[model samples]
Target chain A: MNVQDIQRILRADLLCGEEHLGREVQTACGSDMMSDVLAYVKEQSVLLTGLVNPQVIRTAEMMDMVCIVFVRGKRPNEDMIELAKERSIVVMSTKFRMFTACGLLYEGGLKGGCKV
Target chain B: MHYVVPPDDFTRAGEASSAVKKTLKQIGMNPDVIRRVAIAMYEGEINMVIHAHGGEITVDVAPDRVDMVLADEGPGIADIERAMQAGYSTAPEEVRNLGFGAGMGLPNMKKYTDEMTVESTLGVGTTVRMSVFNHAG
Candidate 1:
């Protein structure tokens, strides 16, 4: 599905990268631990995380992720948004908790992107 | 490219890796190769910030490979074997609260690189060298 679909499905607000709403994403991972995300994420284009920090954006960038969904309405600070803007990564905030957000996206056919 | 990681600056830890990613992108490296290099180096960079006081990262980008050397003067790893184990972190509680220090850093660094080596002296310093080959054989 595309970024727009995720936005609508999760009732998310676009914090940055509005123009990227049309981009497609096939997989996602949800985790608060940046280390786990870095270690296990494989080709996941969307990250659903509750953690709000600049390193979250950095993690997304390092993994080549196209977007991040801040679950539980946890808004990122200006630095995080600016960093995501610089990388052209879409940032969004959702009221859904981490588990719900991941489930909704998975129900919408977005796989986990890793076989384990 | 060379970068100095400021001590305990969690926010700036990935700068070197980000710069390297941009350079590789500009030079039109393969996306897979670029991703591997970026992730590996970023892990190393984060390790420097979290474990070491700070460190120096030198990246040598070649036609066939991207090599990264991260050197830091920190409380060296007491047990290299255990440190390499997933989920065995030595990072303090504050560092864990920052969403890192899960003990996946070194393993992730090794996972993404074609070759990797670690050298450390107790109470002195540690150095990690990693390389990712440009072409998949």
Candidate 2:
């Protein structure tokens, strides 16, 4: 699915990178721990996380992730948004909790994309 | 390229890795190779900020490989074997609160690089050297 589909499915608000809404993402990973995300994620284009920090954007960039979905309505600060903007990474916020957000995305056919 | 990591500055930790990624992109390196270098170096950068109070990172990018050397003066790891375990972490709760310190830093660095070596002197310092080879060329 595309970022647009994820936004609609999760009732999310686009924070930035609106131009990327049409971009396709086949997989996603959900985690609050950046280390776990870094260690296990493989080719996932979307990250559903509750953590709000600049490192989130950095982690996404390092992994070449195209977008980050902040679960539980946790909004990022200006620094995070600015960093994401520089990297052209889509940032969104959703009211759904972590589990539900991952569930909705998975139910919508987004695999975990873990390389276990 | 050389970067000095300011002590405990979590927000600025990834700057070096990001710069390296941009440089690699400008040079038309393979996306996979660039991602590996970025992830490995970024993980080391975060480790420096979290545990070492700060450190120095030197990067050397060549046509066939990208090499990174991270050195820091901190309370060196007492047990390298245990520290490499997936869930073992010495980072305090505050660091964990920031969404890191999951004990995956070194392991992830090792996983993404073609070569990795760690040298630590207790109460002195630790140095991690890693290299990722360009396979797309």
Candidate 3:
């Protein structure tokens, strides 16, 4: 699915990178820990995270992820949004909690995307 | 390339890695190799910001290998083995609350790179060296 599909599935609001909404996201990983995400993720395109900080966007960029879904109604600061825009990563804010948001995405055909 | 990581600036932690990644991409480096370097360097960078009082990361890029050295002047690691273990962290509660300090930083660095070594002096400082080599795609 694409970022738009994920937005629809989880009721997310697009905060930036609107032009790239059609970007394809075959797999995703959810984590509040950036280190775990960096260690385990491979070829994933979307990141669902609860921690709101510049490092979140930086983690996604390091992993080459194209989108970030902020769970638990957490919103990124202006610096994060600016960084995401610079990195061409789509940023969204969702009201669902981490588990619920992940479940919805999984039910909507998004796999965990980890081979392990 | 040499990068000086700012002290305690969580917001600017990954700028060096990002710059290197962009350069590697522009030069047509292997995607796997580029990502490995990026992740390893990023983890080291974060460690410097969180544990060390900022540091310098120097990267040497060659046709077949990417080498990086992260040096920091902060309270050095008391136990290298313990620090390498997953989920073993010395970071404060606040750092953990920021979604880091999971004790996976060094381990993850080792996991992604081809070679890694840590040299630290207690109460003095620490330095990390890691390399990533391109395997035939």
The global C-alpha lDDT for each of the candidates, from Candidate 1 onward, is 0.91, 0.92, 0.92
RMSD of 1: 1.1
lDDT, model 3 = 0.92
Clash pairs for candidate 1:
none
- Model 3 vs truth, CA RMSD: 1.1
- Clash statistics: count for each candidate: 0, 0, 0
C-alpha root-mean-square deviation, each candidate: 1.1, 1.1, 1.1
TM-score of candidate 2 chain A against the true chain A:
0.97
Compared with the true structure, what per-residue lDDT tens digits does model 2 show for residues B48-121?
99999999999998999998999999899899999888788999999999999888888888899999999999
Q: Which stretches in model 1 have alpha-carbon errors above 4 Å?
A: none
Candidate no. 1 TM-score: 0.97
List DockQ for all candidates: 0.91, 0.92, 0.88
- Supply the DockQ value of model 1: 0.91
TM-score of 3: 0.97
Kindly indicate the candidate among 2 and 3 with the higher DockQ: 2
- Docking tier of model 3: it is high
Q: In terms of DockQ, which candidate is stronger, 1 or 3?
A: 1
TM-scores for every candidate against the unseen true structure: 0.97, 0.97, 0.97
Native contact recovery (fnat) for each candidate is: 0.90, 0.93, 0.83
